[model samples]
Target chain A: MESPVDIQDLEIRLLLETMLHRYGYDFRNYTHASLKRRLLQCLAVCNITHISEAIPKIIHDRAFLDQLIYAMSVTVTECFRDPPFYRLLRERVIPLLATYPFINIWHAGCATGEEVYSMAILLQEEGLYNRVRIFATDINGKSLHQAKEGIYTIQNMEEYAQNYQESGGKASLPNYYHSKYDLARMHSSLKENIIFAAHNLATDNVFSETHLVMCRNVLIYFDQTLKNRALRLFDESLVHGGFLCLGTKESLSFSEISDRFTPVSQDLRIFQKKRGIR
Target chain B: MKSPHQRRAIVIGCSAGGLQALRTLLPELPPTYPLPILVVQHIPANSTGLHTTLLNHFCQLPILEANDKDPIRPGWVHFAPAGYHLLVEPNETIALSIDPKVNHSRPSIDLLFESAADVYQKGLIGVLLTGASQDGAQGLLKILHRGGITLVQDPKTAEAPLMPRFAIAIGAATKTLSLKEIGHTLKQLGADTRE
Candidate 1:
């Protein structure tokens, strides 16, 4: 007899397939280990004993499905979470971007807009904000709405302030946002050039001629096939000599699109789109 | 007890004073230690490459931070990256997850040990070390139930004894030894397969 754990694995696969075929949300390409953990968490939240038991409710109930989507994708983020990554962007990439007449940055899988605002703050400090348009996208609509609002928990500001200083911020981080009622609303100026949209890296088309594509911490959730698909999309979207930045733990060394870009900072996982496809 | 040759992997879980424990324990494993050592040390999400870098100084075997889909290689210590759960696939490859934290830790000991138990089954060796929480108790129990060997640090010697004490309370540990003894036991358990 198969173990309960093995049965759970099978149920997870079937549920992922159902979510894809029924709802057109292709979590089928997500990393199986993470997906299974997230789905199990979803099952527990719904008070369901098994993944198979939750499939009917997921298919029939929109609210439950929405909750599942939010829970499945790791939406937990903070403004300027990785200080050094932003420091690298400030020191290396922004100078090249400044030379361009107009700059477009895609914050792909931009969960809750922390890094989007981080990028805006960087550009503003560098006196480059007017020429930049940031496209912040994620598959979760709720996260996108939150991102659009540009408001965050005030409790996070202290740490963000620390991160901003560590990332070579010219001025204080608190200068960028106002605190009221336990929330920090970013200054209106930061939102002027940001476009928040719902775009799935697994199935969506590329945003054209982007100067920098920042998809950090997001690719770790994808299986190899989907990772390559997203990398290809980023490659297609980036202009010649544009930048591609990923999370600290993520790398393109083993990526299918490896040759299409060269590492600008191997330690930071920052790469520049090569002038020619290899 | 299975022979050294039969063992596939060593899954270790530690928290609290884990870094100090690993610094002392990892150096004792011989240079040719044959099984891949997978570790989950509870750390803050923002912590960077410092853990592996610090441990590498004392380790003869190469110590690396575990990345998604990395193939398990013998004679290397793979630390679970902060902010992600590290799992073992049936193929024995390392997989990572951004799933919700368990026991208030992202790279939860229970997640790693349980997944590894599922993958390696009878070929696994689970070790629970110094920790402040009960994170690895259920995982150690799972490993024990799956016919794998499970060890725990002797609660008397641990900096934070609750984790090992809990595992012992649940009868998850087959042997409970001091940190030094645990190191010696690992060397003996892995002696036959040395390259």
Candidate 2:
């Protein structure tokens, strides 16, 4: 006899399929362990009990469907999240990026934009911000909206300050933003070269080739197949010798595009696209 | 030979002085211990992973930090990394997630316990040790409900009593023993608890 949990897993698969077929929002390839937890959490938020019940709501309620996507994909990220990564990018990758008269940095799955702003601050310090255009995109429209607004809770700013310093900031992180009561609004200048848009890693294809692609902490949620698909997207979008930075735990080992890139800092999850696949 | 409990995997959770608690707790298993042991010990997000190094100094089995997508190897102890929750996928591969923290801790014990329970079911053995927070109790209950062996450190023997204390109060533990007994129990776990 199948146990309760196994049945629930079946229900989750059905719900994911319904969402995929109905609205074209694909949670179909999200890694099961994390997706199950988030789905359960979403169920709790909707005050629903079983995973099967979510299918009806998913099919009929358009607003609730967006809410589900927003809730499930709101990956908790911090500014300069992995300090060592930003530090590595600044010390190693930025020098290479500076060679291009105009550069594009794609923040795939940019979420709420903390990391995008972190990169903006880094480029501004490196004197590359003016020449750089950052394409910060996520599948969640709500997150893209927030990324454009660039306002975050002041309570979070302190921890971000520490991360900024640890990421080897040239100036105090607070200088990049102005605090208004409980919220900190990023300076208008930081947004000048940023374009926040909806780009689904599951379905979206690249248009412009990028110099540096920062999709850190995003691919861990995907199964191996979807992960490779996204990695291929990044690989195709990146120019020759461009950099690809993944989540600290993420690796290109055994990936379809594994041979196309060489580790710039394997421990920091930074890689350089080889000039040519030999 | 049929193992007594049919145990397939082991999971442990601890926090606050867990280093010392685990140091004394791990040396009980002999070198050829049969099942993979995954642990969740609450540490700083920036932890340098000193506990694995220290525990390996005395542990008969290898103690290493769990990495994403790694297969569960028998006789190895995989410690959850600092900033992410460690889960065993149904396929028995280690899957790490940056999802919201449960019980205000990223590497939450309950998250590991429940997921391990879901995967291992009655074949799982879960140990709840010293911890300041009440994270692992609900998970321990899930393990017990799934027919797995659940052991909690005797609160009097724990460095921080609240975690195990909470587990015991909820009738989660099948055995409440001192740290030494918890170790010895784990060492000989499958010898007796047959279905």
The best candidate in terms of lDDT: 2
Clashes of each: 0, 0
Task: State the weakest 10-residue window (summed lDDT) of model 2 chain A.
Answer: A30-39
Q: Which residue pairs in candidate 1 have backbone atoms (N, alpha carbon, C) closer than 3 angstroms, thus clashing? A: none
Q: In candidate 2, how many Å is residue A224 off?
A: 1.3
lDDT of 1 by residue, B25-103 (tens): 8999988888999999999887886989988888899999987778899888898998888888766777776666888
The parts of candidate 1 lying over 4 Å away from their true place are B1-6, B44-51, B98-100, B191-195
Give RMSD (Å) of candidate 2 vs. truth. 2.1
TM-score for chain A, prediction 2 = 0.97
- Cα lDDT of model 1 by residue, A1-278, tens digit: 88877887788888888888889888877766667767777788778997898889878998988999988885677788778888999999999999999999999999889889999999999999999999999999988898899898888887789989999999999899999989999999999999999899888898667999999889878877889999999998999999999887788867888888899999888999888664
DockQ per model, Cα: 0.51, 0.67
